[model samples]
Target chain A: MIKHLAAASLLLTTACLAIGPAAAADPGFTDTEILIGDVEPLTGPPALLGVAASIGHKIAIAEANAAGGINGRKIKYVLEDDGYVTARTIQGVKKVIDVDKVFAMLGISGSGQSIAVMPVLEKSGIPTVIDVAPVKFLWEPARKNVFVVGQSYEEGIVHLVNFLADKNPGRKWGLITQDDDYGITVRDGFDTVVKAKKLNVVYSGNYKKGQQDFSSDMLQLKDAGAEVFLAGGIIGENIAMMKELEKLGIKPVTGIFWPGRIEPVLKLMGPAGDGIYAVDYVEPFAGAAGKAFLEKAKPLVSEAEFKGINRYTMTGYAAAKVLIAAIERCGKQPTWACTISELEKTKNVETGVMAPISFGPGVRFSNQKLQIMQADTATLSFKPVD
Target chain B: MQYLVQLLISGLAIGAIYGLIAMGFAVIYKSTGLVNFAQGEMTMITAYIAWTISTTVSGNVFVVAAGAILAAVLLGLIIERLVMRPMLGEPVFATVMVTIGLAVILRSAINFIWDAYPHGLDIGIGRGIVHLGSIGVRTGQIAVIVTLLLLLTAIWAFFRYSKVGVAMRAVAADDRTALLMGISATRVHALAWAASSVIAGIGGVFFALSYDLSPAMFQLGLKAFPATILGGLDAVLGSGLGGLLIGITENLAGGYLGSGMKEVAGFAMIIVVLMVRPFGIFGERDIERV
Candidate 1:
């Protein structure tokens, strides 16, 4: 009787072991659907980024599902508004992780907001693709689960400064940035290039986040006789500074960070937006890839949502494509660990949205290239500068 | 010298807008003994309303401004009648809290309706710079200063001579006493809010003309708080002067000291003024009986 009981226990143990791996499968994944979460600024000044990212994800997921999805499982996307607030972002991450139980996170907006939710993401070991924010902290000391898709603000700024220094040698430079991580990151890049080139930085000023007036700062830059102004601000600040420069009639050869590449800025700045140089990692929405994206996106999204598509939309689309690519490589019954490993193996993945992206081993930031573009007021769009 | 003149002109232009916003605060506080924390949000909403009208009607600046002012006045009356009137005789803290709540609600509502994108108000200014000898000034800045002066004068005259204005002053002095004197304190309160909204609407339009219009523009209303406190929360005309002083001080400090000093100068001035005269430069000290 004792021998018989021992055999029965062994059989039960084998059964339990067989069920453990299946139970350990990632949350929000099923035979028919894979749920992905996004935390972004859908209701605040940065809402444009969130909205565009959402559309990108929707378009990519819809396209994937139409193409028979990943191993025949459709993608379900969930987005929560963080309003560009860090505290709210943490809450959003929790909701997406604990409540929504998403398979992965994509398009987390803003440097601070993304950084704020890193601890929770690490604890969950969820695969995250940061599409909008370009802070280095997201990928540096790289985690096994975190992957960044775009060039860092530091890299973008450095590239632009190098281009400007080459184009207009020995120009007196001024900088007006927001007093935050985003501004500081750009400033760090600008500082690196300035020190390397031994360039003259005539004026450097910073304004509080969400500040409306730039008259005093502009006047100070004007007084300092800066010939080339480096605008290290987001969309609103960039436009405001340009308007102030126009008001003061100090039209320096201006170089703005990536946020200035948006369409609304050109529209709002009108003729004042002319001649301002901006750097971007993605092809402008008017590019061949962007035109293709618009054509594909038109039928899938509402007219309003389509109109909202911009460079950020491309970011979202590219991020989703990468995520989908990783899942496709995970084979049947893909687990979180398998998906993350597949992501690490990504190489030169083409999305027809931005530049080609690749990630592997210790390298997490997939795209490190940037292109300089000039705003044309007539078209209210950015054109690549030769 | 050119730098100094440039800073001064810029300061006055910004100060004039601050003064107008401050007056809006002063008027509401004087009549109702409640600080409308939503003053900034009101200004932002009015500007957006004007922007929407401008975009839809494709009208010039005057038509947009008129439509915005009308909308603001209507909004003010509705808020008073619907929100403030219901809170009559509530604790001051409770009433103030309500306004704070109102501020949040109004801000969210604006975001929900218009989204949070910045837009430019043409206002026919078009970033024109006028050269006065060696110093240059923006046409928008000059317009802001001129408009503030005219608005302040008109407001002062209304309070000094108009029957409704004198009734409002009486109601502010003592609500119960004004009621005893057959002055409808309710009506005065509603009227005060309407007048304040009109001022905010005009200030918002000009502010948008100078800067881009965004939901964050409501922050300017909060920045004008020091101005209101400096001029006396109850003194409408004095708030305007307080705005000018604060603007000039901060700009001069920023110009000479540095960029960081600009934000500090305004708050520091408020602290010094409060220490010397708790009621403010033009605010009347209240005598309460236990």
Candidate 2:
């Protein structure tokens, strides 16, 4: 009777072992190759930014492959350009999943674009590394697979408020923000900081998304004694404001958010962009570390592509680093289940750009600690604040 | 008082550009009895063309502006021949729809060719700030304002004294009567389109230099819509004055009341004007049509 029972248990164990790996295996992963996917904007209005992010991820993927591959298994990356459209982004991600059969996705930029692909991503059971789009609650529920890689908008704004408090205290403040969800979020973020710190925000004005003239608004802010002006808008609005302000001869101390893109501002503002303050998630091609990373990444990309890297590039690089590390931890033949488990175990993963990433059960997004900088129009360069 | 001075300087600069564009709208409507909704898009496209020429060919601003004007004139004539002429006797709605389509086509074509990035162009003008007591103005701002005044005078003179301009007005008043009087209505319409396009070209260059050129710049049409209604759709002088009034009122409301108050104030003023003076400040009551 004892011999019979032992033989029965051994049969059940064999059945369970056969069913486990078969069920957990995602489509593209095999014994020797792991396929990854990405959706970035390569063309359209924001193409400059999109191209930079795509190149950054491509470099990281190439580097990971060159370094003996991930756990001796090669990593293949397939990218589709979404052109900053939410609908196109959804279709691109679907193609990557259905056609390319990638194991995971990384470096999906744009706020509305990500929201477009969320259902497909969640349904596929493929983990996504958030390289950009710092809207809170994307990873708040600890969805077991999704992870964010940038500082929250609130934290970025908090750093700005903290800096302002230190530089010029007891001064009336004003805000000039665009009218949109992102802009509203920025205003709210700054308002929270101001109210919490008991600072005065004298005047606040909201402009439509594509407004050109700000002379009237600026004049009002000046009359209201707004010594410090905080602009929460895109590069287009910022350029318009600068032009109008110059015409009105009212150059109050100003601070603008990173606008998630830089080339637009640099190209438009040119010489008029002197003495502007901005906060960023990562250093924008500054310092020794930044140059070193560029040197390593330069040969991997085209010369024309080098000018494209900005804050998003760093986020892409960080996402790639985290993905590579997770793939490496999943052993030679990584399955979706094993890779996701490894990703969840990420601790102190070093991204060449941005801050060190350490994500676990409760901490799936990076801390919002940021550095502020001043733009030098003469050099078209950014310098770290003392 | 200082605030008022600042508002005046800024308002006049913006108002000048609007006035020029509004005149273009009135010119086309007065001759053809159809509103060219694509006026703003034409301005944007021509400005971008001028910008491309200025940047790539390193051409003079006058050369670029003149080229843009000639191009717009050709475009306007072609639009009349292809789109407007076919539906000459058709419902006004059809013509309106054609103009809308033209606007969309022009905007999309610009996006496809140039992409969506906004480019800053100098257009051979300086942004040198000039202080007039408490008021401050840039060189480009002053130039734009002066250019508007010059354009208005030239247009008035042409319509008042020039034989061709008088013939065009006769055609606008009664096409059948003008045809009987040995005036070719088609030729008159073509001339009106060409002149309107030239005015649009000027407005385009000034607007682009004053504000960064972008795809969204076409939305300036919405603001101009109120200006057109307030100025009288077919009255050129009224449209120009209406644009100035709207610009100044919107600026003052935005400055003193709140940012949100600007659009509100614009509509309110338009409503009051339409109710009190349905023909507008300078518009003829006999020409009033819903």
Candidate 3:
């Protein structure tokens, strides 16, 4: 009879554990670790981009934990490599959501990978902060749980066009774009501005994204007599264009989208890279904000990684800060629903590098465009341009 | 007319690369009755090898280039000994699949050696522009065309005159008969693989100099597949000519029609040629025995 009574009590306790604690424990009291999950492509062509972004998140979370933690609860991040494959991203999200049961996800690197994780995140009611997706469409539809930290490529292009008009007047324009939605979005951005400003568009061409040759395209563009150039493509295409341009001795003022760092271009172009300009949303270990973030972040991220982190890192760091703040607003004992609700109420939260984020009703893009910085050859550094 | 001439010149240069790759395919197909799916990867690897040697050796461009080709030939012999030789009696499908697997392994290995960043070699081919009054061509493009001519001639002479080339042809004609005639079919097959890789190496060097090098360089094989089909898989000279035709047509289509139509034009050309001349413009027609 005594043995039967002990078994019944044990069964009741197991049931209670499965059902979650009856009432919200005091804030930070219930769980051993506050688990967060992230997916980044640590392998594949864009691995460097994902690696830097992941490291940025780790640094920020580590710093938060070191400061007695957010709301006195330690933050633990579980990361997986998606390798930029959509199928793998789905598996990564499922593993994080079902197996790890992360409190939330902080930063996921690619647009396609983020989209791959969307269904799982929505079903699980997991709050997610995107580090790299810039398309407004990604956040628009009132997903209720998703927030984007990067500015749309369209907005970045508009900013670049306006800057170009002011800096170099009467330069006949041309665009070399990839044949894809992202490239089309950039082209549309440039076209809208060209019409508004009455800028002359001498030539335009589109090549596939992963193409290795641009000789024919470059020759045609040169023949069309285009002066100022706008290139909307990934890093590889841009490198091909730059090489061809150097070979042809054509020096057009170029506006290229996010093409990683300056080293490979410099290595390939040698001194020909003089006066060539690129715009980035994050400063490269430059200015007070970047330096401060680096100093604080350096210890947490691997030492091998500190020097190479770019704009993507800043986005990751910013996402982590916002996520922690949202967690804090949930008070003691945070539920996914309540944490998301508190996150929606945030306004103008400063993240040091990006523009302030405000996520109220109907505004999901966290930052409203950060300052575009120009690469300064004199210092071999980046500084905010006027 | 001026625009047309310019397009023609540009197309021929692009086609020359296709022709070289198609020729490599043709040579291997004739000898072994197998399509080397790794042909593009072969070019990519050889180019990268040349790139490394050129960068590290600090010698004249010609010397470095010759050394790179020699290295590629040696590497080709090694690849045959290791990968292709063991699969001599395998089914056609199995052999093709093996080549596909080899291609993937080669591509990944190259990626490991050099990260996916695009690189271009500076081979001191002058950057001067040569203008035909109304039309312009860069020295780089001219060099590509010249190299193609020289390669085609060398291969032509090699097959026509060399005793080993005759044996290779005999093996390609009928492996059983060639074996009965006391020629080692395996030796011919090894020589074919070695020769194809050499072509691949030269093609890679010029390709890097003309365009740039990346993991995507492997896509050049996809572009050349059409050339092989259009030229007749067994026709070496046709490979070169078809590459030029495709290149020129692709350019004209891109320039005159639209970029979206360029791929369509290539496919359309192939379809039309296949419908009219099923054996290809130069390929030998197959006759089945009753």
- Write down the TM-score of every candidate: 0.96, 0.85, 0.85
Candidate 3 structure quality by residue, lDDT tens digits, A1-386: 99999999999988878765435321223454688889887665666577668877887888888886767788888998777788888898888877887788876757767766778777777888887666766687768888777777777788888778778788888887877777788898898899888898888888876666566677667777888888676766676676666655687887766644444544554444545555656655668887888787777777666754666778788888888889888866787777788788878888887668888886677656645555555555556765
Model 2 chain A poorest 10 in a row by lDDT: A258-267
lDDT for B86 in candidate 3 is 89
Regions more than 4 Å wrong, model 2: A1-52, A58-103, A107-109, A260-272, A292-309, A324-335, B74-105, B108-111, B163-194, B277-290
Which 10 successive residues of model 2 chain B have the least lDDT summed? Answer: B120-129
Best by DockQ: 1
What lDDT tens digits, residue by residue, belong to model 1 across residues B1-290? 88888888888988988998999999999999989999988988898998888888865877887799899999899999999999999999999999999988887776689866678777575347788886667787788898889878998898899998889999998889989999998899999899888887777888887778876788888878889999999999889888898889888988888776788899999999999989999999999999
Kindly list the per-residue Cα lDDT of model 1 for residues A73-149, writing each as its tens digit: 88888889888888999999999999999988898978888888889889999998889887888888898899999
lDDT of 3 by residue, B1-290 (tens): 76677777878887888888888888899899999999998988888888887678854688777878787787778778898888889898998999999988887776467655567677677334577674656676788788889988988888889988888888888999999999998888888888888876777777777666776788888888789899999888788788888898888887787555566677799999999999788899998899
DockQ: the better of candidates 1 and 2: 1
Question: lDDT scores for all predictions?
Answer: 0.86, 0.78, 0.76
Q: How good is the docking of model 2, by CAPRI class?
A: acceptable
The C-alpha RMSD in Å for every predicted model, in order, reads 1.9, 4.8, 4.3
- Candidate 1: residue A176 lDDT (0-100): 81
- Candidate 2 residue pairs in clash (backbone atoms < 3 Å): none
TM-score chain B for all models.
0.97, 0.95, 0.96
**Candidate topping lDDT:** 1
